[model samples]
Target: MLVTERTLAREIAPAVERSLPGVEVLAVEMLSPSRFCVYVDHPEGVDHALCARVTQLLDDYRASYTIDVSSPGVERPLRKPAHFRAAVGQEVQIRTATPLAGKKRFRGAVVAADERHLRLAAGDEAVDIPYEAIVRGNLIDEGQVQP
Candidate 1:
């Protein structure tokens, strides 16, 4: 039987949610054959204790592979519609499956987002990108001043 990354996420997400009711499973990525990364968050915030609890809950599944529990961090990935909605008014970087406005990559502030598409203000230009077309999206941490 082949257990893919999605399967692992589906199996583990419930257990994690059950153990920590308020915790949200942001993403599950397979970094290598034996290493998996789990990104989680809570309304209050993620801390060492929360990470430890998640690790403890996933002990059984860890027998065959390594699990690294972590917070989403500054550059949090936007994977779902809800994530995009939450990111409104924040700087974002998006890569579409195909070019939308003569380009595949876009970086700007998300002005609005809905179930179907999101509006991004890239300087003087505003681009509307549909949810299905987004291959990857992440919030840009603007607090770090660039030199």
Candidate 2:
């Protein structure tokens, strides 16, 4: 089956949270067809033990993909509306599936976000990018978006 990255993330997020209380599945990335990375966090912060536990809980995925349970480091992926909302005032870099205003990439402080789109202040321009158009969007800073 051809599962989109977001589809995989949706499937894994709740599964992890339900199985391990307090654990939030931040983002699930399909690095390649057979490689996937799961970003997770907790109120107390993430540790090697936590990653191992998440890995264990996701044992079923090993049969299909190489799963890497990880901590959201300095640069974090923005996969949902909440992620963009929480990153308001934070700098981010994003790539769209197709060019917007003749540009496929953008970098700026997140000025606004709603379920449909995120607005950014890039230099002298205010760019609004639709979430559906985003191929990849990431906060490029010392990532600290309320866990």
Best by TM-score: 2
Tell me the spans in candidate 1 whose CA falls farther than 4 Å from its real position.
1-11, 60-64, 145-147
Off by over 4 Å in 2: 1-3, 142-147
- The lDDT of each candidate is 0.86, 0.88
Task: Give lDDT tens digits, candidate 2, residues 4-120.
Answer: 787888788999999999999888888888998899989999999999999998898899899898999879788789999999999999998889989999888999999999999
lDDT of prediction 2 = 0.88
Query: Residue 58, candidate 1: how far off, in angstroms?
Result: 3.0
Write model 1 residue lDDT over 1-147, tens digit each, in one string. 124666887888888988798998877767888888888999999999999999999999788889999999998978678999999999899988789989999999999999999999988999999987876688988896253
Pick out the ten consecutive residues of candidate 1 with the lowest summed lDDT: 1-10
RMSD of each: 3.4, 4.2
Error of 2 at 23 (Å): 1.3
